[model samples]
Structure formats: C-alpha cells, structure tokens
Target: MKTHKEYLDLMLDGLENTKDKTPNSFSYDVLSAAGILFVEFARRFEELARKFDVDNLEGFELEKRVFQITGLKRKQATYARGLIKITGTVGTVIDEGKIFQTELGEEFRTLERAVIGDKGEIDVKVEALRIGPFGDVDKNTIKISKDYIKGIESVTNPADFTNGYGQESDDDLRERYYSYLQDPPKAGNPAHYRLWAEEVDGVGYAKVYRTWKGPSTVKVVIIDIERKGASSDLVEKVRKHIMEEAPIHWENLTVVSAKEKPIDVAGKIEVRNGYSKSEVIENIKEKITAYLAEVAFKKSYVSFAKVAHAILESEGLVDFDDLRINGTYDNIDLADEEVAVLGQVKLD
Candidate 1:
C-alpha cells in the first residue's frame, strides 16, 4: 500500500536529517522523477505477476500461447439462422449459397441449393456470413435479398438464435483452460465426451451422461457460451464435432442442449458503512452469478451456505438478514439436464 511518494520521502528524509548532508528543492526535483519512474515500474511489476495464470493473461500472449497450449482459441463471429418457405413450381431449383436479406438489410445465404418440393418447403437452412447478434433476425424479418427465387412465402426463425456472440472473453478462455486441466485427455470417458462437446465453437459447457437411455447410450447435454440453452444448429455442430474427434465404438451418442431452469433469487441484505444498498445488491448478484456459473453442471443443488458466503464476502456488506433466496432455507435441487439461470433479484 505504500506509494512511491512515501518511498521517495523516506530517502529524502534520511538525506536531510544527516548532519553531514543538506537535502533541498534541488534534491527533491531529482528524487521526484525517480519516484515517478519507480511507481510505474511497480505498477508494471504487479501486472506481470497476474500474467502467469490463464485467468489473468491477456492479448496476444493469452490468445497465441496460453490458449494455444490448451488447444483452444478465441471464437470469432458466427452465422445466424433463418427459416425460409418457398412457393414455386414443383421442380423449381433454389441454388445453394443463394443470398437473402432481412428487411433491415442483414444478409444470409442458404447452406445448400435445393429444388422446390411438393410442400414447397426448403429443408436446408441459411446462415448469415456476418457474425454476432446483428445476424439474429426476428421472425418474419427476412423476405428477399436477391431475385433468383421464384415465389417467396415466409422466412422466420424457428427458435431464438443464442450462439451468435462476439470474440471470446478472457474469463471464457480461462474457464476452458481450467476445464481442460480438470478433464484431461482420456478415451471413451464421460469427462472426455464432455470436453469434446465443449470444443465446438459456441458451446459453453457440456455434461456427459453415460448410459442415458440404455446400455451403450450416451447423452451430451450442452449449453451455449452465454450460458443459455443451445440452439439446434449448435447441437448438431457438437454432435458432428464429437463424432469426428472422439468416437466411441459400440456406443450410441446423442448430442442435446441443456434445459434452462431459472431459480429466481429474492433476498435482503445489510451493507457496511459507506456502501449504497444498490451497489451491495449488485455485488451480491454478481457473486451469486459467478458461483452458479462455476457449479452449473457439476452440482444440482444451489447451496444456501455458498449464497450466504457470496453475500458476506461481498465488498461493503457488513451483515445481512432474512436472506431467503428462492424462499428456502435449503439448497435448490435441480433435475437432470437442467441448468440454473438467474431470473429475479429482489432485495430490501
């Protein structure tokens, strides 16, 4: 906690107090520059201390070395999905890579060219080349981008696009690296399956259930990196990735998304002096969120003890009372294939 100014003052004081020496403004000027330089050096040294771990590493070092060693890298922009309905002649052909645009000018292309069927349904889906949430078109938002199509009926999203995200965060990479260490490399193991499932671009976390249905049946339940339920597209991507990377002989692998079960938290808290109620509440919520994220697939119960610890350890919170999260003194027990998501935070 000592500042460079304090260090400089000590040196200056020692020189001035010596009977044989005189320390004046002239000496102060020279010491001040050195003090500031030392301060910067100390600041950089502190930063260097944090760069050793994957959790605190940043920039090229993290992306190039740390993440690369873990066999993971930052995720880039992803395509969005749109359902299209075509009403044309029975033999009409919709070429692959046909570009379509939303009413708002967001463009997407068909994955494969297809001929019009009796029902006039185009089974293959389209994807937006541009990544992120910008490609997430609302239902009925897309109509026609090019003039190649015959008759346009409707275009919409069957389900919400949850995987369209920006570049991966340091926290995400850190978690993946830790997971890689925890799971390690093993063949035909549940942890291995889970690890492989999470390797897909948008996958957040994956849980492996051995013998989910019967003998030789495995189910990999996955969630997106944003902690939301995975989309069908992402599920297929995981399925394919797992099939190619780690295949189990004589075992049936099923890739599915985790079901989100929201556990709304309502509580009251008391903060220490100089802390506002809103700030303390937000801090508590963040702690709870982090705790939930870490223990998401590992445990089914949301421990009230851990919740209390998060609140008590939160900055500016001295004490708390009537802290009833989900109205229970007991932990919230979740069913299989269910992940807890934060819903409401009510505090007094």
Candidate 2:
C-alpha cells in the first residue's frame, strides 16, 4: 500500500527529460500531467484495498479509502471540465492610464497590455508584461503568460486576469474538423480539415487541430505534462516551459524568453519568409493559408505564411487580405497526404 505522496512521486519521476523540446512536445508537458497522475493513483488504490483485505467493502468505506489515497474528490472529473479554454479571440494592448516617473524624471507610460500566446509560442515574450489582473469576482483563477502584458497593479476585467490570454476558442479548430467529419470531403470541397489526437490523461486532448482560417495558420494544443503533487514550484515549472519553446512557433516571430510565471506564453510569432527560400517558405505558407481561409479566427499575423503563399502561388503577386490557408510541423514535408492538404492552398 502506497501513500498518496508516494504515488505522485512515482508518476512524476517516470517522466523522461522534456526540457529542450518545445512546450509539451515531450509526453509529460502540463496538459498530459493529469493522465500520469491518474494511472499511478488507480494502481495505488487497488494495492491498498487488497493489502487490507477490504476488497469486499463497497459504498462509503471504499470511497473513503480511495479519497484517502488520491486526495481527489468524487466530482474531480467534472471539476476538470473546462481546465483550459482557448477562445477564438485575442487580447489587445490596453491603456491603463498609468505612468512611471523614474528618479531621473523620465516618464514611462504603461497600459493593461494583456500577455498573449499559444503552445510552442508560449515562451515568446515582448517588451510587455504577461501578469494578469484579479477579476471583479472573487475565487476566479486567471492564468496568463509572463510576458508582453502589463498593469497587474490595477485592473477591472477578470478575464484579462482570471480567464487568461492568447487566441480565444479551442473549438474554433475543432469546429473545422467537425465540419469535415460531419460532411466528408466530397469533390470540390475546396476547404477541408485534417486532424489527429492521442489518448492522454484518460481524455482525448487535441494535440493537433489544423484548419483553413482567414489568412494565417493557427494551432492550439494541450501541452503534455508530467506533474507530481501540488507544489509552489509548479507555477515556476509552467513558466519555464513556455519561455523555452517560443522559437519553434514561427519562422521570424521574435520570441524573447522571460522570467518564470503562470502558463508560459509568447507573442503571435509573425513569420515572414521571402521568395529566396520560397520552397521552404512556401511550404509553411500554403498550409497556413488553407487553415486561415476556413475559420473565422483572430490575429494580426496577416503578414504570416498565408499572405506569403498567396504571393508564390500567384507567380510572385500578392493581394492584401487575400484568401489563404494553414499547416504545422507534422505535415510540413512533401508527402502523399500533402496533396490533399496542400491543394487547400490556392488563390482565394
């Protein structure tokens, strides 16, 4: 029979080194930590029940023992229900009407610029602070990347503080996949969605959901995690993970890693490639265009691969806000499947 702490320790200890990889790239990133916790917990439970010859016990007795080992409430499953929510919206630079006067008399103005970023881009930082504000309501837990966001000293909106920052909407990408799943890609189905998932943490968290949004490729992920017990270091770990993975998010987006904070996050890495490396550049651009064309997304990376692909496919001519597509690391290479995926990129 193992103690709850022992189980947690065993689970977290088994995780491989995921340090150098992008956010959640390794199996034990934050999103996947829940699964790791579940397996060890169940094993310890069975062991304890059999050791005490309490297998026959049912109802409250069994329940009590289980809780004794896991510290998880019965409703914990449901409690985790919206553990994360990426909206189809984005945070805008907010002016908090603040000014800092240095001892030398230089006035530095400030605003409520929200910390915004997504997976892999989590470590990206701006000349902005990522700390969120306390919501109007109490008990609201909002997590933000520790970058490019400011004005934590004063705030009125709980969302910027409680809800978190980054592209809004997890289902925005799922909606696109559901579209194709609901309606099979028939002939001339100009825009189609491809998807994949893994059984992590006992739930099918979406690792990759690509779609044809407006004019850029957008990606959302539940970063894999390997967590043990609840420790104050947990927050710092999350912050470090985000900062380390920012560069892989985009080609040219500037991701400056900062101090450890809440959920690690970086800026909407703006990737800009030219016709010189157009082959590789165009590869990224095409997938991004297809993805952006289909989803009503939110972002300002209009200067991203979407517009770039449009220029290449059009013989070096690009139109402002031209219809485009999207892609990711998985299918970036030229492959048989890429035919269907790449075809999505066209003059729109």
Candidate 3:
C-alpha cells in the first residue's frame, strides 16, 4: 500500500547510504519511474484482493461467479403483459405481431390476432418488448402504433400494467447469497421453499407455510418485485419451478400470490409556505409507499408510528394535526399471506 513518493524515498534513502543522495541524479530518476509502476501494481493488487472478498466484490460477472459456487444465478428481468383495446372499423384484422407503444417509447407486441368486433373494438393481449418496470405504463397511455395499420384507428390500455419487474439488484442478490450461506436450505424445508420461490424472476419475497392444508401440503405466497400481488403468470412460473425442484415425496404444493392489504391514509396537515398542500401530500404518499415496501413480508404489522413519522418528515411540512391509517391509530396487523400495498392518501 506504499505511495509512489514513499517507495521513491525508500529507494533514495538506500542510494544515499551507498552513493549519491542529490535530487535529479541518475538513480533518483530511475527510482521515481520504478516507483510509479510499483504504485500502480500495488493499487491493482489491492483491487484484486478486494475481488476475493464478498463484501467488496464489484461488477455483475464477478458477483455472479461468487454466488454461482452455490448454484445461485442472478435473476433476469421480466416482461410486462397486459390487454390493449384496439378500436377501428368492424372486421378490421389486427395482426398477431402488431406493435403498440406508450408515450415513453416502451413497445408492446400483440400476442394474438384479432378482428374488430361488431362494437368496432377488440381487446388483444400484448407483451412488452423489453423487460423491467419501464413497460409498466399507466392506463390509456398506449396510443401510438409502431406502424400505421389500416382500420387500426386507436388503441388504449384499460388498466395499468403491474407485473413488470426489473433485473435483480446487486444488494438483493447479495442478500439472497448471504441468506443461502447463513441458512442453508436442505431437504425441502420452509427455508428451501422460500429460497426457491424467490429465485424465480419477478418474485420479490415469499413466505412458506407448512401443512397449511394437510400433513403433506406446502403453500408459498409470493409478491412481485413491485411489492404487489404476483400476477397469475408469475404465480404459474413459481409453481412450475418449485414443482421441478421439490422432493418427489412432497405432495400437494401450492404457489399463490400474496393477498394485497391496502393501507389508506387520511389526515389534516399544514404545509410549508413555499410548498403547496398537494405537493406535500404527494411526497408523504411516496414516503409511505417506500415504508410499506420496506416492511412487506418482513414485519407482521405496519407500525402506526412509522406512518406518522413518514408524514412528519415530508419535504414541505410545517405542522400536522390528526393523522389516521385506515382510520385507526393502532398498528395494522397483516396476515401471513398478505402484503401491504399503498392505497388512498387524502390530506386536508
């Protein structure tokens, strides 16, 4: 870990004890050049050493290598799929591969061919071209088509896309790695089921219940990366994966999406002078949503105090009066198979 100057000084001191100690001497210049290379090598060695340590490892490939020793691979992102309504003249044929896009340029392709019905509209299933939350567009935002189609006058999504999930983050991957190391899954235990469920793409967290139905029955409840209920497709994927990995003797495995327990907030609040009430309320909602995500599947109950604190820490809040979470001041208890989701936020 010696610096270039320190290495050079050490070499110079050795030279002084033998021959010349003067600056700009032949040995001094040579040692200075060597010191620069030596320092570079030292820096590289430090970095190389860090790569061996799990806490300091960098880059996706390197982390993947470390985790792969135990058969854990980084989960890839998942595409969002939803229904898009197409409107045009009756009998207009919409090709199976027709493309539609949102204002943000996220593209979706029709999964099936459909013709406009007698009502001049038909709902066709579509899948996002790319993976991740970018495809999770709001309802009515997908109006643009990649290419104009005859009789394809308009298109819109009636509901928001909610199943989109991004690639697993480094932190989340690392946490999974550590969990595997700390609690080694073996012989189809609950931890094994939970780990297997989370390994599938789009699964954020999973809770495993043993003997829920009978002696040999196991149930897994999962939430998506957005901390919302897992879509039917995602649930099927997890179910398939667990079935493939589960022991042959283990029968009756159920993979289901976690039930969403909406948390509604309503209160009276005072906003700072420069900030509008609406802005402050929006910020509070964001903070509360983040808190809910943090506690999802981790805490058995939503802390009432934490919700109030999130509102109190809003960017433009001056003071607050009465605050209620689902019209109750007490912590909201969640069932084991439930995930807390943010609902309505009303503030005066």
Candidate 4:
C-alpha cells in the first residue's frame, strides 16, 4: 500500500517514465499527473511560505502576505471587470516576496488557495482571488511579525526588506529557509480544491519558475508547439526531457518570452536529443523547490546584502561555493566568520 504522498510520487514517476518511453509526447494521464504534481507543488510551496515565515523573517525583517479571491472575474460591463468576491491574507514570507509569488502563480495556474504569516503559531487565511473555474477550498492561514505588520499597507510592496522582519543574521535567514523547505507546514484543503492567485493587486500575478526548460533551442521548439495547441504542462515535460537526453547544451534549449506573452511562437521542430520514455523524472520535487529557492536566492541576495555582508565583515572573507542554503535561505554560520562569509558570497 502507498501513502497519499507515495501515491502522488509514484504517479509522477510513472508519467515521467512514460514520457521517456514514448517518442511522440505526453499522454492524457501523463499530462494530468503533471498538472496534479504542480498543484501539489503549489500546496507544498504555500506550506513552505508559512514554515519559512516568508511573510516575516526574524533576521532580515522582511514580511509578505498571500490572498485568495473566492469569486470569479466577470465583466460587469464591456469595459469594466466585476470582481465578485475579494479575499486573501497578508503575512510575513521569507522568500522573494514579489518574484516568488509570480512564479507560484504560473506553476499553479488555478488559484486554489493561499496563506500569509509572520511568526508564532497563528497564520492568517485569505481567500484566493482567481480567474475561472476554481476548486473548493475550505480555509487558509497567515502569520507575521509585530513590526512587519505594516507590509499589508497597500499590497504589492508589502513589507519592504529594508525594515527587517527580525531576521538579522544570515544564519537566521538560512535556518528559516531550511526549516520552511525541509519541514512543510500542515495543510487542510479539500481534495477537490485547486487554485490560482490574482497576482499582486491588479497588473501581474505572483511569480515562481513556471517550468524548467533544457535550453534555448528546445524552448524555441516548445514555444512553437505550445502556440500550436500543446499545453504548457506537456511542453514543460518535453523541456525536462531535452535536459536528460542532451546532458550538454541543454541550456541551449532555453528561451524566454520577449513580453511574457502566453505564446505566439514559430520555430523549427525535431529535437535531436531527448530522454526516452523509459527514463524517470529525477528530482521532480527538487526541481520545483530548487526553482523557488533559487528565485529566492537572487532576490534575497540583492535585498539583504547589508546584513549578508555583516556576517562576512566579522571574518573579512567570503566564498560562494561554501554557502549553504535551505529552501528558505542562504544560511550563514554565526559563530564562524568564515561560515558567515560562505552565505554572504554569491554563486555563479
């Protein structure tokens, strides 16, 4: 017998294997499983946001919030949008506040639910504002720090990292990140629930790596196919395949949208290298987490340099390779100046 977690992993693995064996592309089941895997990823990410005190950190003093709109976005009039019911929660978050949310939005696509929190046991629940046909979700939660509570001021900017969520040390950031990613928080959404958030307030949505592509060439190929009618879920699978099949130059396949447009691509087809259907998806979980963590890494490094530098200032040294980051942060050792430097240094 398999546990619910095991069940999903098995399904995901099987689908990956199928993609390897099949030369054509992903099947309905594979596509469905991939989609479901992303949903689970979002659920887990939301869980991580809370665990990391993503809404607010004790070291750097950065906080954020997650919101959900229960109602649909319909046109009250030709030029106006009627947001039926508005909902969601704002709390402290540890990862890249603006960027991380955007990536999460792309991955989930179906705003199921979102939560915000700072610290302590209490996390506030905000309804998810979404686009269409969302699943049923019962409740959500959020938590934040006392000083960082002002993050919810106007949304978007939320809690500025400059203020500090109480997380002052790189060690603090690292520990919080590690704890959040490694140990997930408890989730209680119904099985039928699936979600997609309304982005910030209006223009854009929360962000995270939507999918991992092998290289520019492959991505170009994928964009063409996606525009032709292939699903982003399936397209992403194919992108992953290209990575395994073509170990080197997989990066060549990566290509980004010029304007973040859904798709209007046209390109050459026929990938020379791609994984067979027999190959299994290695680190599907890792892939998603890594993407989020890396995104957080970039933002955090930029935002918290002053504090990140302090750790190294004591030691007068810094090294990129030695940095240790858990899901939530690039951890620095408080006692050892060198260790602190490790987290302070940026990796190539």
Leading candidate by TM-score: 3
**Model 1 ranges off by over 4 Å:** 1-46, 88-99, 103-106, 110-125, 137-139, 144-167, 211-217, 262-295, 298-332, 340-348
Deviation in Å, model 2, residue 314 alpha carbon: 11
For residues 163-246, could you state the per-residue lDDT of candidate 3 as single tens digits?
Answer: 789887776777788888888899989989988999998889888899989888899999997788998889999998998899
Best by lDDT: 3
Better of 1 and 3 by lDDT: 3
lDDT of 2 by residue, 282-315 (tens): 5545544444333212221233444344444543
Tell me model 1's lDDT, rounded to 2 decimals: 0.74
Superposed Cα RMSD, model 3: 3.3
Q: Give the better candidate number (1 or 2) by TM-score.
A: 1
Q: What Cα-based lDDT does every candidate model obtain?
A: 0.74, 0.30, 0.87, 0.27
The regions of model 3 sitting more than 4 angstroms off are 12-19, 58-63, 85-91, 100-107, 116-123, 137-160, 248-251
Q: What is the full ranking by lDDT, best candidate first? A: 3, 1, 2, 4
Ten contiguous residues minimizing lDDT sum, candidate 2: 75-84
Per-residue error (Å), model 1, residue 100:
3.3
lDDT of 1 by residue, 85-201 (tens): 555567777788888776778787888878878886655577887887677666666677465666655445554445575566677777777777877868778878877887677
Superior by TM-score: candidate 1 or candidate 4: 1
For every candidate, C-alpha RMSD to the true structure in Å:
7.5, 26.8, 3.3, 28.2
lDDT of 4 by residue, 1-348 (tens): 224445555555676434453323456445456656667777777767765553343322332211111222211111111111112344433222221122134111112232344332222222223332221121121122222332343222122111001111333234433443454322311110111111101111111122334222223221111111222433354445434544336545452221221101111112113432112112122232233233232232221333333323322122222322432343222211011111122222
Return the lDDT, model 4, position 163: 8
**Candidate 2 — which residues are off by over 4 angstroms?**
1-164, 167-205, 208-308, 312-331, 334-348
Better of 2 and 4 by lDDT: 2
